[model samples]
Target: MHRLAIALLLIGGAGTAQAAGIRCDGGLVDRGDLQIEVLDACGEPDFRDDWAAGSLPAGVVAPDVTQWTYNFGRGNLLYILRFRNGRVIGIDNDGYGFDADNTSEDCGPTDIVPGMTKYRLLSACGSPAQRDSRVVLRSSRHFRYGVAEQIRRETWIYNFGSRRLLRKVILENGRVVRIDTDNRGFD
Candidate 1:
């Protein structure tokens, strides 16, 4: 493989935090701080926006990015943090943030449940807070090492803040198979 591909593989394989803290409060919130640290520093964002497919600028990687919106009472500039491959790559001041908070205490029901079709799930929850997909090759239970089985796994995250925690929906073969939750509530 080429150098870029190799680097992408290595970076993606590490499975690091997709989003992190915003620079605010006259203090510094640097890139690669992780989601928890971001939450601790920024408190809670007013609203969030996620994009799975879009026109990326030249030389930028596609997919696997989480964008956060923080509105500190409107007078302050809205912070938009973009995390790529598990770390914050850039931070910008978006025009304004929603008056309504995006926290679990504020966000409506996730509308995600087991056995729901991808379409229904998307329609209900919108494009996930963050998305990650991977392919693994392993031998089946038969122990035929030469005959490897391919497994495709996709994980979608919805951050509902501390009240509802974060929801992790796991899918296999384009179908929901399991659901998990954690306190890492920032999507």
Candidate 2:
């Protein structure tokens, strides 16, 4: 029993290490790869988001951050690649991918929830009928001196026809923060 437990622990650690890299077009793209290299290996991603962090000093420029989401297929898991400056910094698995051809109209407004990625929302609910975005400065006590960061906020309004109410999904940075139901939707 002791030997079996040791083996299982080793296997779990190995699985975590393996998740640091992803395969693309017979090539492996790992952390520290350049953005161009990932693009060449993986081709274009299904969804892309670009934003910049706020700097503390007046003359300092914050690095630009980009997130690329790839959905291989229904049988595979969705991957989100985060790039800082021009190099890959991290890779995260969002959720299970769905068939692109069959997902557009398959979900309702209640399917959306906080913390879900925009890529997942798009896959489940399709494009929003209306979209609006703006950048706001938010101050946080976590940082020394309560520094303010410029954050991007977006509102996506989905119309599910007259049968369902309109859903307004609010996103901060790139993740969904809140979901609200408006009045009845149009036909």
Q: What is the TM-score of each candidate against the true structure?
A: 0.38, 0.75
Which prediction has the highest lDDT against the true structure? 2
Per-residue C-alpha lDDT of model 1 across residues 1-187, encoded as one tens digit per residue: 1001000111121112222334454334666666666666665554444445343335434455566655554344445566666566765543333333332333344466665534335534667788887654446777554444444567988777666778889975344768898665643
On TM-score, the leading prediction is 2
Each candidate: RMSD to true structure? Answer: 16.1, 7.4
Residue 30 in candidate 2 has what lDDT?
76
Could you give candidate 2's per-residue lDDT for residues 79-146 as a string of tens digits?
77888878988777665566677775667877898988888787788788999877666778765775
- Those runs of model 1 whose alpha carbons end farther than 4 Å from true positions after fitting are 1-110, 184-187
Clashes of 2: 0
Per-residue lDDT, model 2, residue 141, is 77
* Candidate 1 global lDDT: 0.52
